[model samples]
Target chain A: MYVNATLVAQLVVFFILAWFTMKFVWPPIVKALDERATKIAEGLAAAERGKQSLELASKRSAETVREGKEKVVELLVQAEKQSQQIIEEAKAQARIEADKVIAGAKAEIEQEAARAREALRERVADLAIAGAEKILRREVDAKAHADLLAQIKQDL
Target chain B: MATTGHEAAAHVPSAGDYIVHHLGHLNTTGHPQASVVDFSVINLDTLFFSVAMGVIGLLLMWVVARRVTSGVPGRAQAAVEILLEMVAGQARSIIHSEESRKFVAPLALTVFVWVFLMNSMDFLPVDLLPMLWQGATGNEHAYLRVVPTADLNGTLGMSIGVLLLCFWYNIKIKGMGGWVHELFTAPFGNHPALYLPNFLMQMIEFLAKTVSHGMRLFGNMYAGELLFMLIALMGMGFSSMSGVGGSLMWAGHVVAGTFWALFHILIVVLQAFIFMMLTLVYIGQAHEGH
Candidate 1:
C-alpha cells in the first residue's frame, strides 16, 4: 500500500544499496582496469628494452666479423712474405755451393798436369848426359866409334 | 518522527496500524485510512512528491549552471561542477552518443538528486509533521508520506518515464519503421515462422526490464522504511515500561537510532546514484535498436 512508512523504508534500502555499490563494487572494477593498463605499459617497456639489446648485439656481432676478416687478411700477407724470403735464401745458398765445387775440381786437374811435365823434363836430361859420356869413352873403338859419331851429330 | 521530541514520548502504535498508517499516502481527501490509488480513490502524495522532486532537481541544475564560473569556484560551485562532471562522464561511457546525452546525461543527474531528496525524507521524525498537521487542522485523520520513492506508484512512474525515453531514443536513432521491423525480425532470420518467437522474445525482454527496474527500487526502499518503523516501535517502549527498563529502553533507542540514521544517510545517496546510472545505461542501450 502507499504510505509514508513504505516510502521511508524503500528510501532507506535504496540508499543502502547505492552506497554499497559506490563504495565497494565500483572501486574494484575501476582498479582492475587500471591494473590491466599498467601491465600493458610494462610489457611494452620490456619489449622496447629487448629490442634495444638486440640491436646492440647485432652491432657487436658485425664488428667482430669485420675484425676477424681484417686479422685473416693480415695473417695471409704475413705468410706470403715469409714464404718468399725462404725461397730467396734457398736459391742463394745453392748458387754459392756450385761455385765452390767447380773451383776445387779445376785446382785438382792443374796440379796433376804440372807433376807430369816435371817428370818428363828430368827423364829427357838424364838420357842426353848418358849418350854424351858413351861417345867420349868409345871414340877409339872401330864399329862403336862410327855409331857414336852418328848419335852425337843427331843430338847436336 | 519518533526521533523527534514529541514522538520520543512512549506511544507505541500497534504494528499493523503502524504499518498501514505509515503506508498511507497524503491524499486530497485528508483521510488517513483512505486508500489512495485504489479502485475507489486516488492518492496525490505519489504525484506531488514526484513533481516536486523533479522541479527541485531542475531548479538546482539551472541554478548551478547560471552561477558557473570559468575560474576557481566556491565550495557550492565546485560541488555542483564535480557532480556534473561525474554524471557527464558516466553518460558518455554508457550512452556513447553526444546527441542523446544532451538530454539523457542531465536527466540522469536530475534523477539522482531528485531521488536522493526523496529518500532523505525518511530522516524526518515519522510522526513529526503528520501529527503536527493533524493537531493544527483538528482532524483525527491526516496521513502524509514525505518520501516519494517509498511509494510504488511513484517509482513505477519514474520507471515508466525511463521506458518512454527508451522508446523515444529507439525511434530517434532507428526510425519508427526500422525499430518495428527489427523487433519482428530480430534474433532470427526474416522468416514468417520465426516472427512469433522473435516478437515474444522482444516483448519478454522489454516487460522484464521495466518491471524489474521499478521493483528493484521499490523493494529496497520499502524494506528500509519498515526497519525505521520497527526501530521507532522499540523507542515507543520507553514510555510504557517501568523505571529501570524504560530508562534502558530509552538509552537503547537513542543508541540504535543514532547509529541507523547515520548509516542511512550513506545508503540514501548510494541508491539514488545507482538508479541514476542504471537510467543512463538503459537509455544508452535503447540507442541500439536490437
Candidate 2:
C-alpha cells in the first residue's frame, strides 16, 4: 500500500519498453499493411482492363462472322446466275444444229425424186417401140415402112 | 488448515495472518513494509515481475514484427496484426497528429499487452509460487506476491510515466510559454483576478487524472487477488474437516473459485483496455488548447 522507489524503477522500464516498440515493432507491420492495400487496388484495376479487352475481342469476332456470312450468300447468288446463263446458251446452240441438219436432208430428197421421174419416161418410150415392131411384122413393103417409122418416132 | 511436514507441531497462522503474509512483498529489506507511503523503500517482487512480464510480452511482438508480411499471414502474424491495427485505430481516433501517433500508438500497445500479462498472474493458485519459494529458500515463511499490478506502487509508476509524456507533449505542441499561459489564464479568463483559480484547477485536473488512472487498475487487481485468497482459505477448511460443515465449505469454495476465475477473465482484459484508453486520452488532451 505504500508509494515507494519502485515507482521510479517501473517508470524507467516503461519508457525503455515503449521506446523499443516505437523504434522496431510498429513501422514494418504498418508498411506491409499499406503495401497490401496498394497491391489489391492495382490487381482490381488490371482485372477491369482485362475484362474490357475481352469484350472488345468478342465484338470483333462477331463482326467477322457476320461479314463472312454475307460474302457466302453473295457468292451463291452469282453462281446461280452463271449456271442459268450456261443452260440458256446450250439450248440455243442445239436448236441451230437441228435446223441445219433438216435443210440438208430436204435438198437430198428433191434430187432423188427428179432422177426417179426421168427413169420412168425412158421405160415408156422403149415399151411403145416394141409394140409398134410387132404390128409392122405383117406389112408388105419394108423400105417404105422405114421412112414412116422414123417419122413416128420423131413425133413421139 | 492441516499442517504437514516439520511445521506440524508449530503454531498455525490465523486467517488474517494468512492474507497479510500473502500480500507481503519480497523486497530489498526482506521484511514487511512499515509505512503506507514510504519513498525510501523499493519492492523487489513488483519490479522483477513487472519487468519480466514486459520482456515476455515485447519478445512475442518482436518475433511477429520480424516476419511480418504484406501477403497472406500465418496464425501468429494475423493475431499480432489484429492487435496492432486495433491500437493504431484507437490512437488515430484520439490523437490527431500522425507524427505523435508514431510513438503513442506503439506505447499504448506495449502498455496493454504488459498490463494484461501482469494481471493474468492472479489466475495461478494463490500459494503455489510462494510455497515453491519457501521450499527453495528453506524459509517456511518466505513472502512473495506475483501480480505486480496489484501493488499500488507499480500502477502509479506506469501512470506517472504517462503523465510525464503528457507534460512533454504539452510543451512540444504548445511552447512552454503558451502552455504556462493557458494553464494560468484560459480556464476562467485572461484577467489577473482569475489566474490563481485557473492554475489551481488545472493542477487538480492533472493530479486527479493520474491518481485515478493508477488507482483504477490497482484497486481492481488487488480486490481480485484478495478474493482468490479467501476462496483458497475456504478450500483449506476441508483439509482439517471432521464434520458436514467442512465438506460444505470445500464445495462452496470450488464453485465460487471457478465462477470468480471465469468472470475475472473479462475484468482482466477490460481493466487493461481502460488504462490504455485513459493514457491515450490524457496524452491527446495535452495536444489541445483547453
Specify the highest-DockQ model's number. Answer: 2
TM-score of structure candidate 2: 0.85
Tell me the docking grade of candidate 1: incorrect
How good is model 1 by TM-score? 0.61
CAPRI tier of model 2:
medium
Q: What tens digits encode model 2's per-residue C-alpha lDDT throughout A1-156?
A: 877899999999999999989988888888888888899999999999999999999999999999999999999998899899898889888888887888778877777776676565545544555665667665435477667655654555
Q: Per-residue alpha-carbon lDDT of model 1 for A1-156, expressed as tens digits?
A: 443333333334333333443443333333443565687789899999999999999999999999999999999999999999889888888888888888887887788777776566555544554665586664355465667655553554
Best by lDDT: 2
The lDDT values for all models are 0.69, 0.88
Estimated TM-score for each candidate: 0.61, 0.85
Q: RMSD of candidate 2 to the true fold?
A: 5.7
Q: Score the docking of each candidate (DockQ).
A: 0.03, 0.62
User: What's the residue-level lDDT of B219 in candidate 1?
Assistant: 77
